[model samples]
Target: MRCAPSAGAALVLCAATAGLLSAQGSPAQPEPPRFASSDEVNLLAHGLLQLGHGLREHVEHTRGRLGSLERRLDACGAACAQASGTAAPPPAANPVVGDAAAPETLRNLQVQLKAQDTRIEQLFEKVAQQQRNLEKQQLKIENLQSQVRLLAPSHVEHKVIKPARGKRLPKVAQDGDTAHNASRLHRLPRHCQELFEEGERQSGLFQIQPQGSPPFLVNCEMASDGGWTVIQRRQDGSVDFNQPWEAYKAGFGDPQGEFWLGLEKVHSITGNHGGRLSVQLQDWEGNNESLQFPVHLGGEDTAYSLQLTAPVASKLGATAITPNGLSLPFSTWDQDHDLRGDKNCAKTLSGGWWFGTCSHSNLNGQYFHSIPRQRQQRKKGIFWKTWRGRYYPLQATTILIRPAVDASAS
Candidate 1:
């Protein structure tokens, strides 16, 4: 019963030591220990002192029991000798005196107890030494952390470079833009239609994440019916649309001005099979024309091929050409995926498109402010054949896309 508390205390101390060792030996440094303060160390030391006091009290109590047992035995023996003359001995004292092996067993127990006490004292000393080592390591860590804090500003200064006055700065992601992009991406609408559904009416640049893809900027054109995600816009020809395959794939342009909103982004926004495409074309005389059709745009694996069904709506009265750009993979000067064998439609027409036999529509063609003089140069301008043959370059063009289901419902 006396050894029970001591055994429990020993187990507690062993577990604490093991935990401390494992923490210190860890490969990855953990956050600063909570017990690094002087007050915590003092509290631990006080606990150890109390344990020592308890062990000393236990030892004294054991010694007192041994002394009391010897005195009782002496009294019992005297009582037994004078049993006939005096009275009979006490029943409790008689057992201690009559039992021959009791004294030897008690002595053996006393010896074992002394050995256990010595071992406990040794363990206490080891624990104290470990405590001291831990304190020193904590102090060193605190100093290192302080030094790092002091030197961080200097390291940052060394890494930053200031551009000279009147010198054009190199292109890099500005901190403000990066921060803005991050904030915009955190809560993004799936598409422009979603913004329209949520009661947004203004047309402007917006950030969107299609499906589960990374967020990117897009221009949302709002109409009376719904919002439209503008994929390509050719206005003043500030941006060249005749770029090679890579440029078209990654997209090149500004959302505020003329820009092509990349093929990959278009494919993602269009979803599984395809979506609806809305085209707005204006001739040099300001004769505006609009058309909508159900179109399926393939991915880069298919060279972003175009497959359009019959036009759902058209503002360009009746025309001879049908504007059918069906099942023709997109073509560029570098990578020709067009249907023509001898001539690259993109190279010949000086624009990129899903050119089947180099006809139909080339909305991504070269932009002209007005009518061109040369007859041969006329074919290179932005023109939709169904509205105004292939030679009359259109003044402006805007291409927008949305889901086919949404278009049908609208």
Candidate 2:
């Protein structure tokens, strides 16, 4: 991926001496910040918010300048028009001029007037170009602000859950090993597991292929299990589904290779509610792909009835996709998460890490999740293909999708 230049690059456009002083002041002051495990998420959320504020302020400044230039141009046009209206009163009969001399002087005056008109046109053109550039930059700044809000916990909700049918699943999955193909999903087509796993904690591509068909709708949601800390459920579900859930138009080769439900958990720096992620899919018809290994939210693991319609087979390389999201990659369960008597309250899924469950500071206390330091530097593979060559990194994040009731029937 191409690394973008830092914001400092934008400052160079201002006056050179002012930029130098600003540059000196910046280094002399404290550095912007390098995310810390203790508060990475907050830093990011807050930093973006601050940037949005700054951009809005600059946008206002540019708008004000444009207004001033517009007024001056209008005045210049008026003066030019008034001068033209004064039919040159027969130049006071040049007392010593031959009628030819009068024409020469008038011609010189006309040349000056033409030059002035040309200069005004050039000025207007320059102003118009500036206005367009300012507008483009404003649009970009606003877009970035919207993304900041998306990553903010206060603005995002998680989507989660799925079900199982006939067989029995283990009481709990191994906290340390999720790669063991002995898992049920391994026996299924490879693409099933690949898509789900790729978006784990945010790594996968969801292209919205329409092929003159209905547009598939996707949304994400977050939930708190009655007894499990968001972290514990994330780390210890026997029926885990941390895999990426991908969507392609019908008949995309019936999926490939092998796949499985993968689940993992991560602790918030502040240790609030632990996060849980699961990935499982079903078509409109009746094909049960990963029915053997189910994924879940907070409830008991049971077969979720999902129906597959006529399998949609798309032309070789055509499938529309959208963003499905990702989940955290680390496990959060441990001895510290056990809640003794509080059966009604939610417990931590990841245990005693900074944000897991404990009697004093419960997981349900506040929904704030901390951004572990170094996470920004870690590649989550979570990129959204907003368009070609436009992959927006998922950064350190999570995606949860709740399947429809009928989605489990198959």
lDDT by residue (tens digit), candidate 2, 1-410: 00111222222333354456446555655777643342443453454445445534544454454456445444454444445534334555541222223333445644554554454445345445544665565566566654554332221223212211111122344534345424543222112122233232232222111122222212212223211111121211222222211210011110011112122111110112122233222222322221111222221111111111121101111133213211111112322222233432222221121121121121112111222235332112121121111112221222233322232122
User: Candidate 1 lDDT, tens digit per residue, 150-261?
Assistant: 3321111222323311111123436555644453434456677876776667676555667757877677888897779998888898998889989988888866578888
Error of 1 at 381 (Å): 1.2
Error of 2 at 251 (Å): 17
On lDDT, the candidate that comes out on top is 1
- lDDT of each model, Cα atoms only? 0.67, 0.27
Q: How close is candidate 1 to the true structure, as a TM-score?
A: 0.51
Worst 10 residues of 2 by lDDT: 247-256
